[model samples]
Target chain A: MSEPPARRRLGPALLAVGWLVLLLPPFYLSAFWLQTGLFAMAAVIAAIGLNLLVGTAGQLSLGHAFFLAVGAYGYTWLAGSPAADEGLSGLRLPPAVAFVAAVLLTGVAGALFSPVSGRLRAMYLGVATLALVFVGQHILLNATSVTGGFNGRSVPPLTVFGFVFGDTDDGLTVFDVPFGGLERLWYLGLLLVAVASLLARNLLRGRPGRALGALRDSETAAAVMGVHPARYRAAAFTVSSMYAGAAGALLALVFQRIVPDYFSLGLSMSFLAMVVIGGLGSVGGAAAGAVFVTVLPQLLGHFADRIPLVVAPGSTGTGLDASDAADFLYGAALVLTLVFAPDGLAGLLRRLRLPRPRLRAATPQTSAVGEPAVGDTLKEQTL
Target chain B: MSAGIDVPELRVHDVTVRFAGLTALDGVSFTVAPGSIHALVGPNGAGKSTTFNVLSGVYRVASGSVRFGDAELTALAPHRIAALGIARTFQNIVLTRGTVADNLMLGRHTLTRAGFLTSALRLPHVRGEQRAHRERVREIADFTGLGARFDTPVSLLSYGERKRVELARALCMEPKLLLLDEPVAGLNTAERAAMARTVASVRDALGLSVLIVEHDMGLVMRMSDEVTVLDFGRRISGGTPQQVQRDPAVIAAYLGGATDAPVGEETR
Candidate 1:
């Protein structure tokens, strides 16, 4: 059935307001908030990618952090100056080119794992990808020339057409406020998040999305409908990795440093939490989830001293540290989300907005005596 | 509505399929003439579904070949067989979680050519192609009496409507040959009658061959142009419904060796 005119109009108007809100944070927020916002945006991009794999294609990947690391390192190596005395090698390409190349590089890495990803189904593929984290960690720790060993290397600031994202001695002002590196990167992050979401939404609403969803439901049904399961599986993995790569690159830009310790199994788990918390197979859900998961810990840290039962990190207080408190809250949130709202935030929002229109529409068709009969028929049909 | 389509003959010759030590289908042979309704009927575990699986390339046969037109169906992958204008539905409803339009659009997967890149970019031609295919899908939905429920989720549909969704989905592929596995197995009497009428009209209107695996002998005898009876993975009888109905082997197979018991009693 066609949607009511009012409901149809509400979507675009809501989206415009959301975009306006997103665009305003950099102009007024403090550095801490901007940095947290940037991290959330990066997480949003990566979570969207992960959702495409785990949610849409029904493939499980615990190696998302590994791909993110690849993107971060790939960009750093591609754009960094070749410091011969320091024993670090780089292609020294332009940052913009390096950014695109890094994303493609991550895609190639994902493609390399396709033989494994394509053949293995959900949990099996997850276990298989678990190995990539360990392998990536080893390479990151031991590859001293590129990774700088225990001490991480500094990230080169991204420059697009000679305009540096790094802080300048005389910074450019926007709306009577000085836009430094964080502020500059804020816009970049916003642009990336917007583009990433648009592309993902387009993909999900199109032909590939339908095939992938069918594949998730039943491989035999998808096969008979002319969907190549393995091929689509591989494509999903590759595209997801590319998204992870872009996120990693943006994250490196935000952090201004790259550390091997950060790209651990825990990071991969965090990504999984974002997608699951957001809702599977939903682009908007993934973004909402990413924002929640990424921002929660930082928000806790920011207000740790004020919040009850939570102390600042490294304090000798007997209360829970901010990070530990964030972890506990995340676990509780995940459990509650799984138990109460299994469809995640997106589903919950949808449920809140649209109140069983189908049932309502059916009600007007029959008299009071026939209502139970219709309901019974519906119940029997559902069963 | 489906004019100018090249309906192809399906030839299955001595196809044998074995799962481990158990022979699921053993040397079963049949041919479905182009533009005809051919029903494969038998008792439970009579290798009817097994034969459909082999034809759809879900299971590999131990021996023999399945030829659809000039293509050897046995050698190709499931998607490749589908690409050769073959589509199918399962006995169990295997619809994805989405609206009817989404499931029907999946049937048009082979017909559309937008990959991840073009779809993500939403190229102008991609939108044009999607709109065009969606228009056709709507028409197919209307033809199958699902026009009203085109945007309705598959989960909300009645059992009978879901069966029709499956049929409509396969029809969306514009298949020259349609494979339906027990399309009306759990359907009520009225639903079964409607399904039978739709199945007949599909052949008449679309000029496509149908390979149907069903248990309802009444609908099978009434609708099918030819009936192939399978008993213990072997073809026990093959002919017109009337000829097969009176065949002693068919009657014995259905009534468990009671040659005197007419097969009409097994209609339910």
Candidate 2:
């Protein structure tokens, strides 16, 4: 059977545009801007997973940071302390093994804790997962022997095939392109982002995806249809956690450090806000939401100082405080998004594209296909 | 997955149900042959729905047993009953929010357990099963007079169309016995007539035995081969419609004192 042109052309067309976006940046942007862009790109990767769990699955998680912390700590422990028991200090291990281990362990840990989430509904699950933030931070801070405690451990540079990455000891060249520091790291970050996005896409399109949607629509209906809702729900959580872990491993490599403070509740809240502002159950919404969220702080921090607010700046009020400003704006955006656009920003975009004038006239006729009204649904079967 | 037994298509023996202090179904005993359309009719609050809930495995029977083919219904879950070739429709439409095709596709979920990993990976098996599921549902839609609107979302559908989709979805399950509760409860005369035809055709086409709980007196009289009447949770009469219509207890329950002013009518 022949496939539609739209389906055939769609992926490659999008990929071409994505390649342009990633490869053309060096020609137009400065180093500092590139640095900020990389940070935002990394954040986008993490937010996509959060969007799936919260938006598509209708699960409420307040412990996304736990996965990131685990990923970072796990990578640093396994990679940087490969032979800790031996006399050699700062023992080195292959970065590939560490990355894989981090993602797997995080998935396992999430599966372990996800059972608690399965038993409870939204509010209780949110509260329970919230404890993960405190617990994760405590473990990272107190496990001095492995995590390196308060001062935080320095993450060794990742080396792929003898090509060292992130602020290299000495600059190196490969095929006329620099394979050191920021340049090498940028390629790695983009690669992770591409891979994660592909995985998330496949996930939301298949059986697990359908199961998640079924569970959300009606638990009783799902149960009646032979779907074990609890098991799939737990699986969604674990899969989402694995994505978070992968993103976190990349983040650790980018920073070349692992710290307890980076994975905080505030960071978790940002991911939540992104999913809320993005349409639930939508992949495009996740990307759009991440872009808005990732770029807003820059515009605000750089320009919001000039744009007057209620509080006077240069006073004790501290209106320009970056962290407080980001929090306030994110909180306000979430409430506004909920009230004005319950379906989220992506839904708002879809609404704009729709033919408002024809919506009503088209409904009945368009839906005339197979809808069995309430009465028909209850039609007495006679033989 | 066939079990060796001579269990009736459905056997509800001495099933008694209570609500607060009132009984909903008092020792209701009935047997449905393998291929028969049994009609249960009564006035409002007749405990017909309670019987449906018990039969479909939604509500646990307070007392007595429900056997479907070779499987015991009481211990089985609603979905399990459905899986065992006994599917039912609700009084209120329970179609999920999606395209008409999607709703029916969900019905085939039990039959199409394509592994999660295979589906996620978009394997050939996944595509094949999905195509088969859609084709079966499309056929059901055509039978239900919904051949045109397969892609339209249910939210955009009217009450009648949505109900059609719900029934089509259930029909796609290929049930041996279909339990339909008040299928013609709310509809215009023409729509009801069309539904009656649709129901009769679907049953005949699939060779399915059905249990119909209905409130429409004319429909119940015309459509059912046998009628069972319940009043205040107790079976008052069971026979052909002519026999049930002529029974004194049935008449007394509807009209008081044989053609005087009706029961509960104000003298003023």
Candidate 3:
């Protein structure tokens, strides 16, 4: 028998809607909103990666920002002019190469740290990962040549072949809209996020992904099943770090300059918050959570004067400023989401959908609660 | 089809396991023949589980060696041991978070060749391998009576169903020697019988040896080709079920019914 019509149509329907949403921002969103969308896209990519590592593999890492810094700075140094700083020497490679290299560099860095990552358990791994942040911060601050030290450095705009993401001498316009930096980047960011999401989803659904989930649940069990826990953990960490690298490179491009402060512990925590609030193990949910977390502060800051009981940054009579308000809002949201729905927003969405047939009777609610099915009796070889 | 390697008997020679001041297994030795069901029965703390652990490469031998085929298992890592055709289940269910199908596919880890990058790229080869493995997983799940619950999360299965899933998962490894720890520990009489039948059928169907660490003496007596009894970290007896059952030392250590009663009458 064929699948029900509704079930068959669901895939195309979801794809159609996803495409529409992805295409709408460049046409309708203002530059300010487009910039916000770009940041959200970057976060979406990173959060999906983090979910794979922290949620799927059950390895907690607190030094994601270290990899972000590596990506941002790696891109800047690789593509920018060597003479821009005292001892800094840029390879002056293509921005696209620089971007890809930056991501791979982060993977290499993660691989380097696998000695600790592969050996440590969840809580201890997290603690060990924290060391990456401190050590990264020290290098970024002291290595004035490569990182531009405390002041940071200017990022070279990404140029793919001949078409620059940045504005050209004869600035291009499409239809009635100006295709400036944000508009051009809107498309680029959209493509990257789409690819990233697809890849992450694909990874999670496949054999390796299942292996990772098994490893997370029980190392001994996973090992017996021929899953090398340490190897998988290291691979997950490296992949996740590479995703952070891509996000960092994108962020550097959007900001037009890079700073060590931008890739701080706070940034790492915000990424964690995104995954947690969106739903830990769901890739699509991570994107939604990323958008929510990234846009809230930007939106509040934009409408700071109008928002009730909220002031702009640097205001003296702050009940709560825009940034602080965003923090409080998301903090409360995180706590409420966890308490109300441990699975996060994705779980809530699942519940909102219409219940399907008894195709899957193995949900935790119905599982293992009562007597074995009568049909199962025949299969048993009771002594 | 997997390449043919000479399936050799597993020999444990004077293997000792010590944890700080306590010795979990003291000079325990036994051999499991090719394609035969070997039962390891002992009271709690008699080192039955420890023997399984040592054989499966989870515990290091304080002395002596374990030979599987020609390779020494005692020196290899757990996963390496698994790759060398030994797979085991836990005394406690150690299923990962996923549907019954997902957990079953995890058992195919050692068999699959695609790595992370190939998988991430969704290469044609990876896709093909995945389809082939999924087909096998489905068939195995069906064989183990879990075909209907392929997509069901393991956590939702009843304890008995979960135990079957665990067995199905181990079978997915396509091991030369299967290690089942407490396969029927929490099962009822009928379920225990069913489990015993399943294990025997699996051994026959897969053409592999079975090493079962079970508390249920009745199931062991019925299912095992050979039985070994352990008591207080020492081998008390070894022979066929009838021989081990009638051994005086086995009776003294277990059926003698000391204060720390052996897993005896209740199981029988």
Candidate 4:
């Protein structure tokens, strides 16, 4: 069975638009918007990772920010130069090696927590991971030599070969626009997001994906079907943490400074809200959620005077600030999504009959482009 | 492929299970011969499910041993027991939270060599393995008369169809010893007959031993080569279906009170 003629053209048309947005951002957008887009990209990667763990594997993790801290600090410590005068110590390694190592280091940290994560389920796991934020905070504050204590530390610019992702000795210019840090980092962010998205999609559509889905539905059933619950959970957690690590490194590059206060329980909750608002278990949904969560605050700030009940950040008199306004909107969005649109924004788009790439057939007898009729069944099961 | 033809025997030796001062299984002893169907029939609370759980490694026995051809199964995990060529189906239908094809593929999880990394990377051999596994799943679905429902999520299927999906998944494991708990519990008359046919066909095609705990006396007597009767966690009688049906202890415990058969006459 083949798709209708109308839908046959829609897929490529939509894909071309998506690629155009990714490729043409730095050329037209200002530095502020470019930086905001970079932040959104980083968040998209982390949300996708968290979606796999919480959405797909049915494991709740509130320690996502702790892994992000691990990645940020790991990159700082490995890549930063040793400053004896400032009592700071680093390996002074190359930035590329440090980036890879930091991500792997976060995976190792996640593996270390497997003993706890594998044993706990649902709310218990969430509360247990919550403690990780506190533990991470304490370590970041006390480890002055590595983290520079509460003051945090500066991030070394990521350089590959002779090309630097910053304003350097010889900066390049394209279209009369100086290719500064944000412009160079935009391409880097784009590449990482692409790779991360590719990996997440492949994993979710494969054999391991089915095994995890079974384990989520029923542990006893999964065991009988030959899925080891503890092993799969641990593996999912590790991979998810590695994704967060990659995101954290990118975030650090964007910020150019890492601080202990940035990684907190609030940050973890925001990441959770991002995935829940996007639609759980879908990679594209998670990315959409991440973009919404990351860009909403900046958009609010840009039009702070015009939007009602929202005031500037520093001058607030009973009116919501930019960040607080974003939080309230997302909090309300989360509740509404859970109540009415349980599948979030992605589900809404799907309901509108927008054409989507059918990588795997959702129904056995349907062709590659058939719309899934299992939504009603899913609602009944969940209810 | 022929190596698995020598069906492994399962022997439960004086197995007793106690939970919080209550005896769930009391010195239960039974054996399933190679390539034969054995039935354990009992009342609703006669610990049939408990016995099935003990055999399938879901529960540990308080005393005695479970031997699957020389290897001890009492201490092994459920997945480990499954790896030892023993597979089971849940009484309440524990289906995967995905399509029937996906759930059936899970049955071949132990056989597939691809891990999360290989699958995520879409390695060459991973595609080959997935294709091979899907072919087997399709065959199993067809065998269980579930070919039309292959792409349908199991939650969307009817009760009888869901039961077939469960059985199909267990069969996909290519198990030497199949444990079915109350296989025809909620099925209608036609569904029950169809299920009996599928069970018989599966055993005949695979040449494997089957240990089934069922309450349908007609199906039990018709399908089983050997029958064991249980009453309040204790075995009342063990023999051929006709012998067990004729025994006074079995009659007094369950058959007499439940069925309308006379002492010396056959019911089914």
Q: TM for chain B in all models? A: 0.97, 0.91, 0.94, 0.94
Write one digit per residue (lDDT tens) for candidate 3, span B1-268: 2434356799989989999979999898899999899999888899989988888888898998999989999998888999998989888777777688888888898999888888888999999999999999998888777888888766556778888888998989888999999988777777777777788878777778889998878778888899988898999899998887767778777756534333335544
Residue pairs with backbone atoms closer than 3 Å in model 1 (clashes): none
lDDT of 4 by residue, A1-383 (tens): 13478887997799779967788878889999999999999999999999999878888999999999999999999999988888999999899999999999999999999998887876788999999999999999999999988989999999999689866757588988788899999999999998998999889878788777777777787787778888888888899999999999999999999999999999999999999899877898999999999999999988899998998799846689988998888888899988877777776665556335442222222111123223221111100
What is candidate 1's DockQ? 0.50
lDDT of 4 at B13: 88
Q: How close is candidate 1 to the true structure, as a TM-score?
A: 0.96
Cα lDDT over the full model 4:
0.84
Ranking by TM-score: 1, 3, 4, 2
Q: Between which residue pairs do clashes occur in model 3? A: A367-B156, A368-B158, A380-B194, A381-B193, A381-B194, A382-B193, A382-B194, A383-B193
lDDT of 1 by residue, B2-113 (tens): 5658887899999999999999998999999999899999989999999999999999999999999899999999999999999999888888877899889999999999
Q: How accurate is candidate 2 locally (lDDT)?
A: 0.72
In order, how many clashes per candidate? 0, 17, 8, 1
Candidate 4 residues lying further than 4 Å off, grouped into runs, are A1-13, A316-318, A351-383, B1-4, B255-268
**Model 1 DockQ class:** medium
Off by over 4 Å in 3: A1-8, A84-88, A316-318, A354-383, B1-6, B257-268
The worst-scoring run of ten residues by lDDT in candidate 1 chain B lies at B258-267
> Candidate 2, B256: how far from true, in Å?
6.6
Error of 2 at A98 (Å): 2.7
lDDT (C-alpha) at residue A235 in model 4:
88
State how far residue A356 of model 1 sits from its true place (Å): 4.2
